[model samples]
Target: MKKFKYLFGPVPSRRFGLSLGVDLTPFKTCSFDCVFCQLGRTTNHTTERKEYVPMDGVCNELNEWLSTNGQADYITLAGSGEPTLHSRFGDVLEFIRTHTRIPAVLLTNGTLLDQPGVQEAAARAHIVKVSLSVWDTASYVNINHPHPNLKFDQLVEGLIQFRANFKGRLWMEVFLIDGMNSGPNDVKKIAQLARQINPDCIHLNTAVRPVHHDFVKPLTGEELNSLAPLFDPPAEVIPEFKTTRRPDFQTNEDTLLEMLRRRPCTSEQIAGALGLHLNEVSKYVGKLLRTNRIRKIRKDDNVYYCTVNK
Candidate 1:
């Protein structure tokens, strides 16, 4: 698979299988600076959604892939940052529908859901997954670290409203960062809110990959299992969902190494970015590091190897 600056994964989604993903916003442009974000930190944190990248350029590239490749289970609008920040997302969604039969899925942090136009744009998507990490405003600020312009009350209300207006399935993904949003009191409050919203499914997930902060760690299987009953419809561990084919996309070892230059990634993220098998990715990365194409750094006792030179 050839790498495109505009698109990245059909990364293994615990929910959507071999899902084809589209990056609507430019890199690192997001509405939140989550403590558990895999992409590191946010460079831009405003809610404004202009055509950050030319819409026509992205559409053309997407059409090319859709027309040539086998159909994916879902066409997900997600990438290095929040997908909802793309102001022309409605146009992008419409463009995707015109070109492919795959269902559209929108992955969002749920900060912008308060905007009517944002909600309207999402209506075209077959599924919308919103993140509900913390229950109260203080916890939301401490953990998700949304744009200063966004309000926690408005975000929750917007998600609730989106559930009402959109006819598609709503899946709420709760990434429980230990000691931050995973305590009994926090889970209980979040469950109350989930009950009010009534989403179709509640995905209880823990950090499986390296994240921005050193403090983040995925909850033990036992911890997640015990906490599943808090959400309205009740939550389930992400792995409970059936696995599908790996996502189809293009990426070279060089591209994978380039992405790794800035941050550390697990084998899964590297494979998803490059469209390679995990074993294959390990082989290339090992080869590169040995040849001085990259270097390895360890954080929290975890080794992250990356390309240090072009």
Candidate 2:
């Protein structure tokens, strides 16, 4: 298979099946350094929007991937960081729409939607999934740890305004932590806000991957079920998607290490990319870890292996 600079996967996704991810920002560049982020803490937390990745380069890669391996459920604008931070986000969505029939999806942190340009760009996607984890400034700071300039109220207002203008499917994700935003008062406040925004669906998510903070933990099935009815739009807990079939590509230590040298990836991501089984990927990862060629880091609730230097 041909290697792509900006394209990452046709990886199995629980929400959007077999998603082909398009990464628009540099690794870990985001507006919010959420405690439950799967890509680890945001290394460059900022609200500034720029052409972080060359738009032409991304389109070129997309063209190449479509020509060779066009099989994907959704061409997702999500990977290591928030996709909305890229200044040409709408243009990229346009490019995808012009070139292919596959529907585009934008996964955002919902902080930048206050900007007219950001909201306009985001409105182009077929599905816009915004994350609203907290209802107040204190909880926002505690959970998302956004850039200094962003306010919780501004984010909520943006969602409400965006929904008023957007014609596509709008899905809101609310990430819950055990002691942070799981109380009745917090859930009720979030429910009220959800009603105001009127998203098509409200997804209840908890930390299911390895988290940067040790205190963050996944809610049990019962706990998730109990919280589902708190919202007016009726929330559903995001379920884990599992697969037993092995992927098509062959993976070895050198190939896995070479890929890790580029960016850290979870065993599941590696498995999907290399077309190998998760257990098979783990064998090579274990060997790499023992040899000190790669190190393990916890983000969200998944363990990602990366080059030691990274």
Candidate 3:
């Protein structure tokens, strides 16, 4: 298997099974830095749209992977940061459409959809999944901590307008924190906003995995179920991925070290990202810990392994 710089994982995904992730932006380069982000805090929080990574390199790598490995369930535009922030995002989507039979999916924060260019670029995807976690400006600031220029109402307006024009499936994800936005009043306001946006489906999610902030907590099954009815759209709790699919690449000690060198990850995340079994990941992780190449850190009751320097 080839070592790709920009492409990683035909990882099992709850929403899109066997998702091949195409990372566009650098790590933590996003407009909104949410407390529940799996990749931790935002290091570079901005709303600027530019070619962060070379467009030609991304397309070439993606084309090479597809040519060799064939298709997954979906070729997802997602990674360590926001995909839409790449200025040539539409071109990449167009390349996927022209080259492959597989569906193209965009996982975005939905902050920049207000811009006509961003909306037009996003429309190229077969399915666009956007996050709408807060109902008002106060909650938005509290949870998301978006760029200074972004307004809560503008973000909502963008979703509404984008839905009206986009022909593909529009799935809206609402991330719930235990104490932040799970109250009756907050949920009701979110439900009302969901109605106005009129997405094809509403997905209720929580911080089930390790998050940056200790205060960010996952909602239980019962809580998620109770909140599902608040939305007018067909809504359900997003389930965890339970698949036997493994990565095509070799999952060896060196591979594990390389992954950990990039960022901290749990056994499950390592398994999913590298296509290794949980048990297999544990073996490699244990060896790394013994070698003192990596150290373990606990956050939100979940353990993560990273390089000693990290």
**Highest-scoring model, lDDT:** 3
Q: Supply candidate 3's per-residue lDDT for 47.
A: 91
Candidate closer to the true structure by TM-score (higher is better), 1 or 3: 3
Reference-based lDDT, each prediction: 0.76, 0.82, 0.84
Worst 10 residues of 2 by lDDT: 242-251
Whichever of 1 and 3 has more lDDT, that candidate is: 3
10 residues in a row with least lDDT, candidate 3:
242-251
What's the lDDT for candidate 3? 0.84
Looking at candidate 1, the ten consecutive residues that score lowest on lDDT are 241-250
Per-residue lDDT of candidate 1, residues 175-237 (tens digit): 997788889888999989998888999988876544656778778778998899766666988
Ranking by lDDT: 3, 2, 1
Report lDDT (Cα) of residue 283, candidate 1.
44
- Taking all chains together, each candidate's TM-score versus the true structure is 0.81, 0.82, 0.83
Please provide the root mean square deviation of candidate 2 (C-alpha atoms, Å).
6.5
After superposition, candidate 1 runs with Cα above 4 Å error: 240-303, 306-310
